[model samples]
Target: MSSPIALHTIQYNTQDIDNDTLILLYKNLLKPRLIEEKMLVLLRQGKISKWFSGIGQEAISVGVTMAMNMDEYILPMHRNLGVFTTREIPLSRLFAQWQGKASGFTKGRDRSFHFGTQEFKIIGMISHLGPQLGVADGIALASNLKNKNQVTAVFSGEGGTSEGDFHEALNVASVWQLPVLFCIENNGYGLSTPTNEQYRCEHIADKGIGYGMESHIIDGNNILEVFTRVTAIADSMRQSPRPILLEFKTFRMRGHEEASGTKYIPQELMDTWASKDPVINFQTFLKDQGVLNESLEIAIKEDIISEINTHLKIAFDEDDIVPDKTNELNDVYKSFEYQEIEKKPETNQLRLIDAISDGLKQSMERHHDLVIMGQDIAEYGGAFKITEGFVKQFGKERVRNTPICESAIVEVAMGLSIAGMKSVVEMQFADFVSSGFNPIVNYLAKSHYRWGQQADVVIRMPCGAGVGAGPFHSQTNEAWFTKTPGLKVVYPAFPYDAKGLLATAINDPNPVLFFEHKGLYRSIRQEVPIDYYTLPFGKASVLRKGDDVTIISYGAAVHWALETLDNNLDIQADVIDLRTLQPLDTETIYTSVKKTGRAIILQEDSLFGGIGSDISALIMEHCFEYLDAPVKRVASLETPIPFLKQLEEQYLPKNTFESELKSLLEY
Candidate 1:
């Protein structure tokens, strides 16, 4: 193993801070340590499920938290219980959360450091370690835009620095000059992987230099050193608004969790670190400085013991708040009464691209907190020139051109949405959304169901295959998001639906994946309303009504289904456009299928595991007896779209839908 970095000696005058303040600081450090020790006891007794102890790393959290103002936000990870204590989270509530009580932060949905209170400006960390860093960037960005003069402090372990999100977050923060303090708790070991195996750098702070930002390496065990430096940085950041990377060189002192054994750690190293324990060393320093006497130390200990016992009793008495079948569907999506707005007389003939642009403009004009962020979206408009002139109209602050980090884009949007801003993120191509899949699935989609939190983000994906855009450029990946719960999937074919649906997505209080067909951006034009209006989600529009067969489709495929029906006038198929896929307009679908016994489902995605399969299943379940024949599905070939014109033509479902319709009519 490499030799440890040399620690710079920091001197402090004990008299500078009053004895009461010093005693309270020591108590803050003691709170989490005692609580965690008790948590270990509970773990052994089956009172709590797990414990991620921050026993040795108390000084880092308490010190930094003390340095920041109470109004500022702190995004904490699982190991940072000291932060929760320092932030004045009630011990009873903390214990209640650990005990899975009804009065806890997540109402017993999550336990043990997996909960956060927006009221306290604390964003709880998800299972994925690195994405929260990007979220912190978004929080800081929002503060900057709103001129809040607040600095968001986000915590991570030395292991998280190796993740791609760390790089993406720091780069974006550096480029945008966001006010974020990136805190890395260098605990020497990530589970069992040692620092030497994790990265070659002697100090994790060195990575910050490459991002063109300030970097600091501090002795995390020293409370005075951490507080003194963090206070200075936090105060300066409010005015200058720049990100700082601070590495806290510390040790875990325990296993990754209470159940994990420490046999992997060498005995010699454990003994060496035990001597440098922050709590013991700080106590010794206080005694030497004549700050804490034996009598006072005993009194403080008794007081903390009494407080813990009181909270423990209350938490233990609380009822277990487990989810039941009755409340299972509660808070999945925000409930709103839908009111239909009549179409206006004055309408403009717009292409799909222009309608999307206009809808974004109208939404931004209505809500000042709405922000548009994507690659090349600000001045250059976008790759397809959809957001052209947005920067000029909305200004650069609202129209942001982000770095080429798709995961960060989505995660940051989640952060912004959590911070009470509506973020509309554009994936330059639908294929690139794979890079951001984790946040979309794990963080954004599950956030509401997990914590009663709303991720009001609109992720605009330019999707589908046409005009020979090839494999990388043209991909209909809507099936992936449609399958995920807590997400509203919107795929509009015409200009009117695109504008109306996009507007609704912006105003909706949940995460929405708005898929726009690149093939129809300029090819499809219709007379859309000039003024602002929103179409209700989960309401399918019947484009053409007929009695022979019912055809269901969305996005670019809807046009092909309609064209096929128009070409074969004798077929007389009822065409239904499912604009929103998640809160599927099953009422309209069932009604149409009930009317026309024969059904056909069409999609631009592949045949297997496509959204059409879900629709087919839905029809089979509800409209099975009504159907005269088996539900037929027409979808693209199960292969990557090729670049050649003929292959690309063969890859889409347009031809397949036409052929399938002919066979369905004959049946």
Candidate 2:
């Protein structure tokens, strides 16, 4: 690494730091208070809802985060109320958010002042505390990928250090050597629990040592100290990717949440903390240095208050950015609160591969905003060559190659989307998605519910097994994400459907998980539309119909079902291919079961806790009466996928479909 730099805990008695320079720094530090007061005042008048104050913690936040570029990024917790002003977040929009008005930042879809942004890299807040830090690591990783001079400044509470996610993000950041500055605001409490109870370690700064990082313990209220440490760390980060730990010894001075206060705080301890208040201490330190006086301090406060109020006025007075005017369905397949009848094409023409490739070409040709990211996809056009020749047609920026950090890749895609770009991220192997599970479940899936309308990226994982992916590469894992409500999960078996579902997912406002089966990538080839088009989300297709045993499946298993029923005279099995796992096609299942009186559920995922389980449960709830006999399920045996092809063949569900169907039919 670079030469080790030591941060002094001793007094800085070095070269003279000019009085004028210090004053300017102090002015920047105090400027945020103007907005802080304005917001709190509005909250009291019921002009807004509630606030988690940064009233006494301004010096540390302003000093550290302002040292960063706004176009860079930050994942702030509740105490980031101070950085909001430096971020130039419109106060009127904040008020609108507080009042739950249509003019709010998220168009009344989010709470006061905590929401995502399209124009700025400033992320919306996360309610679960440590989850936001995971995103911070992602943003920094994205910066590394894009070759940009930016660092992600993540703020969290001392209490958050106890969460497994906090450690996970830190470990991944260290492993990837990401450019991230972690600021742990030691407000002496972790919610109702105090620091003394939460940890017995010396300090959070020491925690970085385990990750081979340098850390500092700064006076949280001392703007000068904060600025020096944070800037130096940020500068070094840009030079090379490395994690830095910063422990800002600040105090809460208020309750954890808006409605909650620190009544549990003893009056004597509160008085002691008030005496050490960062805002007041920094102001006093400035006066002692002869850099601050009564008149000058008053003037600075007035000017800042004026500046803050002006922005607040603009946000409050300005009109809202209306949501989609058409008020369409939640996703492409399902119109906003409306359903469309999807009739099968009269002709059985295009293979699924051609359809998928054609869809990519049409969509990219139509929208200048769409970008494709994956490994080897640029040169090799992916393992299946679905994206072949696209890089030559569209430049590298639109079809970018990526390093192999799965979680970090997802993080970057999510960040770019949050910044108003439409990004598509690919997991080369579906099993590798385990690497990015943290971002998917904790950040991307929950960002909107935590703040508002934060879904920005669409993730594509090539999933399912048929041609011997064994366990690692072939398993169908759609059910892992289907139960998660916010994300849209699509698994199509044909070319036309893949193109349509992918187009819909790309345009949908929320994050989408498109699971393309590796086995079907080449097997399902067909003539795709030469022009651009979008297929609706939440729609299913019935490929073949019969009044016998009904087989319901998606992705590779659908094709397997088609083959299972192919030329079988004794078994007239109806086939239903559910393109969407999230909004399961219960109607199709019920209709088929009522007509056939026997049913078989099939997927390539593990037999335990997979999509088949979900479908079986639904049938019990809605289609139990139609069952002429017991329902049967076909899925992979419960075991980790083995590398040996023969063992994998036995473990997988492909060979079981025919036999399972026979059992259901005979029952």
Judged by whole-model lDDT over C-alpha atoms, candidate 2 comes out at 0.72
Residue-level lDDT of model 1, residues 1-667, one tens digit each, is: 1122233233444537777778888999888877777777888999888888888898899998998888888999888998998998888998888777877887777777776688777888888888899999888889988999999999999999999999999999999999999999999899988899999988999998899999999888888778878988999998789999999988888999877868899999886677667777777778778888989888987888889899999999887676686565766666656656656789999999999999999999999999989999988999999889888888999999999999998888988987889999999998999999999998888778767778989999998888788889999999898888889899998999999988889888799999999989999899999999989999899988789999898988888887876787788878899998988989999998899998999888998998889889989999889988899998889899998999998788787677778787777
lDDT of 2 at 335: 27
Tens digits of per-residue lDDT, candidate 2, 625-664, equal 8888887888878887775778878877778778778777
Error (Å) of candidate 1 at residue 452 is 2.0
- Give candidate 1 regions above 4 Å deviation: 1-15, 337-342
Compute the lDDT of residue 374 as modeled in candidate 1.
94
**Model 2, C-alpha of 241: deviation from truth (Å):** 13
Top candidate on TM-score is 1
List clash counts for every candidate, in order. 0, 18
Q: Each candidate's TM vs. the true structure?
A: 0.97, 0.70
